[model samples]
Target: ELFYPKNKQHWREWLFNNHHRKDAVWLVFYKKQSDRKTISWSDAVDEALCFGWIDSKVESIDKESYKQYFCQRKPNSTWSKINKEKIEKLISTNQMTKAGFKAVERAKQNGSWTILDQVEALILPEDLKQALAGYKNALEYFDGLSKSNKKMLLYWIISAKRQETRQKRINELAELAGKGQKPKQFR
Candidate 1:
């Protein structure tokens, strides 16, 4: 069976109606028109994770775009720190459940909880900046990136787990930018 929401915010109300039965196939759509007024993808994901749900995958239905096919979390799936913080906020506000708590405990026991250890804020790290300073043309191209593109690059960098990993990413990003390349979605 399937249920769909006009946007992510409405999904919260629907979750209430369903009482989070633990096994329902929910297809959440991201109608472009939804941008007219909605809570946004980030909020939606946080709310979903708070309730022990995770995004499975999305499928585009048409030109305007329609997202599909999400389901509740299974026992084995791990959690992200970002989502864990969201759940913690939910718990503080009396929004958590035994099921949700159980999931958190499982994550803790399996080391998934700490594995998500605090992510640094999304900002352009010095490494990328250093790389760009070395190449005038690349700096020009990097400066030409739209706000969204630059923000996405910063986000991708901050999500890196280790210094070596981030250095590698910086190298790749600099090489691409040096040749007038930006992140795929940047263009």
Candidate 2:
């Protein structure tokens, strides 16, 4: 569904009504409209977070507006550091709903809440660094990667639940890097 909320209150009302029933909504935001004001993306996200929803998959609709997908937080979704901090503030301010608190508890129980810090530094692991050394092209390609891509690759490597899986990801990344290819999703 597509919704264009005039302001944060409108967005909050929509979430109040549909946070449980709807699987997702495409929230439309005005980019440069002079006569019509709309909720900014950051504001929209803050409201959504209060209701245990998350934003993803933004798409430009026209010069004046765009749509962002918002949906209920998945059971195993990894939380970002920024979002974690936002939730903390939300809790302190008494803005978080029962559903939102439940989602946070789930993340805490499953250990995804703390994993964001592991990826924040974006450092290459010793195993991957050594592997990349044997492939000069791969090392160069990794060096040339954008900071986000590098962080993502590092996260993929370090987030593995097992040492074997982590080693496997390191090998896969090195092999892909050697071929002058980025991970499929990044490309």
Best lDDT goes to which candidate? 2
Model 2, span 25-108: residue lDDT tens: 999988765567899888898899998899999899888888999999997788998898899888899988887888899989
Q: How do all models score by TM-score? A: 0.50, 0.80
Q: C-alpha displacement of 117 in model 2, angstroms? A: 1.7
lDDT of 2 at 108: 93
Worst 10 residues of 1 by lDDT: 115-124
lDDT of 1 by residue, 1-187 (tens): 4555556657777665554664655454556564534345666665566566666676676655556455677664656656767887888888666656777788778766654232233245577889877765787787787765775676566557798888877777787888899756555
Q: For model 1, state the Cα shift of residue 81 in Å.
A: 2.7
Clashing pairs in 2: none
Candidate 2: 10-residue stretch with minimal lDDT: 116-125
